[model samples]
Target: MQLKNILFTSLLVSALTYSAKAQFVGDALTFSQENNGGTARFKGLGNAKTALGGDISSITGNPAGLGFFRQSDISVTANYLNANNKGTYFGTNTTKNKGRVGIENAGVVFYFPTNEGYHGWQNFNVGISYENTNTFTNNVRYEGVNPNNTIVQRYSDLMENPQNGAWGDKLFKTVLVEESLDPKNGYFPVVGEAVNKNQVSDILTTGYNSRTALAFGANYNNKLYIGGNIGFTAFRYDTSQQFSEGGWTKNRAEILAKNPNSTIADPTHDDYKYVEANYELLDDYSQRTEGSGIDFKIGAIYKPTTDWNIGATITSPTWLTVDDYTSSYIRVDYYDKETDAKPFITKEVLTDPTEDSYRLITPWKFSVGLSKFFSRGLLSADVEYVDYSTNKLRTIGGSNRSREKAWDQDMKDSYKAVVNVRVGGEILLTNTVSARAGFNYFGNPYKNADNKQYSGSLGLGFKLSQNVYMDLAVVHLVNDYKVSPYAIDENHWKSQSPVADIKHQRTNAVLTLGAKF
Candidate 1:
């Protein structure tokens, strides 16, 4: 390869707006956080456990609830996760579904049975747990033709306004195109019309958010429960994408009809009689993010009667530092205008990898719950509110302070507060078996849109022997959003780019085995 072409390959890779991120611009807040991760019973009960205690998983939310346990127990949950993401670009629609396995929750709780009659302190409990809270494994494919514009303009604009703020125009000339100055457009460069072409993209996303926690709590007079948890959280996220645009733009059938004597005889751009050349773009980009953090939680439950209980909890924002890495490859079918044909393939892999470190402060949340027990059944409900807008991003260096502040301000402007609600009920089916049902509502984080998620859950529990049991639960989630195949960032904002609509759905099934001593 020529030296200039090699430089072009490297510069163009850096010039594109693509980044290696665990969190994309649209799903960052939602993807970085975890959902409630616990036992099958906890999930089966809609995770409305603030006031309903007695399960080992409850320690994750409010350690005080663990006070309800009178026996020491251990549990492990296995899960099956399936996600289907659909997208529509222009008028074509495509869907991709992916399936995988995960361990959602596993933990143990120890209860010190107390006979202390003095101060009504019934018992003391301590627990430690590890749970997988959120997942990012998914796939989406969208394909269509964009008739209004070409990525050539995007390349030209990048050359005009370089990212480093110097010699961008000079560097642009080396790798991308031979630019001819135009009065109105500044630099005019076109391999061809890039119309009547094909556009396609396939992306795979994968990751997980998990946490390990230690909790302690005590029960007072069998009427009150108080507990707290010290937690450490970590996550890994990655996205790999393959996108292509353009092919043969014009056909010969329509050309010969216009000029009967004109000798354009075939559909391929190889015909020398054709006035314009043809080109294609095939590119791949992939990025990964890994992070670890810490946080704290405190909660309490008050039971005035044996059958009724009320509870509330406060969760502190997590302080996290994240590391990101990214790399890319590009291939172009260069069109020779003089010959009116594609001469050769220009392919280059940007082997240079980029890395960045940043700090993040997640949102603080508050929750309240109410539970009622009956002779044959029980009902529980919880309400939780989080301010998504409170999420902030900061670069590590003093010189990057302004960049971090700008990003933080942008997050505040783009996001809003959301309230999530969970409700569940249990119906006794037999002496040793019970049936459970629940519902949950997660408010949309985007303030300008009405996108929300609703989930329904069903579960069953059985007691196989005196100290052993099993629980099975299933939950379904659905939501809708939009994405784009490519952005016209250099010339026009993404809002001006073609919009692709998407609807995503997932199902999680979990089974928990437990033994009590």
Candidate 2:
């Protein structure tokens, strides 16, 4: 019954939004997710994960592999990344690139070998690690026209139009009367289309995400290992946008007069007209949320022969609580010298509202891996599976219809099969020294019309000494895609014609250093 409920809940949660913009939710950070050279070298391989020793950072990949660690160790790694973004408006082209440095992982592990153990219990191991799982930083600026007033204001109007219905009509009646005007409305009827002649442009946005997990592992009889992670995650996001519109002076004055005691009003009077003019939508929203969750993994290692080993693990879902805060301001501009109203600054109300509690469930994972030690070298590989359908978006009281819809659409449009294939081996350069190389392929999470992206990785590791060793590895990632946002039609009030094609290329690199004690 519990399993059935889990599946049912997963399906229900996956029924949410799939919009391109909506999928840009919560937190996204790459430095947090990709820290080690080996992990990045092989697109995060797990089956052959046991070959890596020291530290519990690999616990997320496979817990049973912990049995390979025979020494107490500490390791830390950092990552540097470069991101390039490209977009087009109509036929015009634009591009952007940025660089960043981040701490990847730092942790320690302790091993206790059982000298006299019964029931096949070989040893016990405990560890604490901080592994960053995601990093998100991207800037996209495409200028065509400012659709905020035309689209958002129009939607608001539709909600108020009496002819449309009671709900929308009653809500926006005042806004419509104040917006629709002759002569200088700026929105002129050209070829039966209300062309937004007002030059509307400029948008800026930024995002941050971090997750710190406290994890522990135990190996029994060197055959079975179990682990669990208690993770604390924080998400930060901010967006700012500005644009221009003409003849908004009157509407501004009316709003202030109605709300004399409002925070966005003048000190002396509720004079909304003072700010009524061609103004900019100066908006900035930020949310800092924290959540705690638990993820457990159980695994079994079978060694049928001295040189061969096979392992499997099952992972539980992570449950999180997210608290978010948002605020915005609308400022108008009157630059036309011919107008009677002089240029003045108006501060619209400030809104720092907190959302109800929200919940996030990462996908459940199942994996298997194999390793072999031969006369010349060692070889390993891993396979993993996760179900995206079992995720959900919810507030404290319950799930949000809008957010849920967005998540569902994202899942439906996304590719489900995420296959990670990695193969690496060590060649003994000397009795005490070895050279290692690995290759990994992580299938793209998003499917395309042409099916382009599936990131591939390569890395090298070197052994320094018996009790001490250091590894330096570099990884490169490439992701290319074509995505489109929701389209607007001619019937809509000043809507942008459809954007024909959108293309994006992302290249990422990481350098990781590790030391085993």
Local distance difference test, each candidate: 0.73, 0.46
Q: Residue 203 of model 2: what lDDT? A: 39
Model 2 Cα shift for residue 461 (angstroms): 2.5
lDDT of 1 at 192: 36
Model 2: lowest-lDDT 10 consecutive positions? 4-13
Model 2 Cα shift for residue 112 (angstroms) = 0.9
lDDT of 2 by residue, 1-517 (tens): 1111110001001112221123223231111122222233233232147433333555555555555677777766666666665656555566767667876566666777777566566666666666656555555444454333243343343333344343333323222223233323312211112433233333344554555655556666555555555555555544444433343433334444444333323545543333433433332333334455555666666666768877676767666665544433334333424355665544342323434456666667677778887896677776766555445555566646776677556655543556556666655666654455555555544343332433434344445555545444444444444322222223434453323123444444444444555
| Deviation from truth (RMSD, Å), model 1 | 7.3
Q: Once model 2 is optimally superposed onto the true structure by TM-score, how far is the C-alpha of residue 216 displaced, in angstroms? A: 4.7
Clashes of each: 2, 40
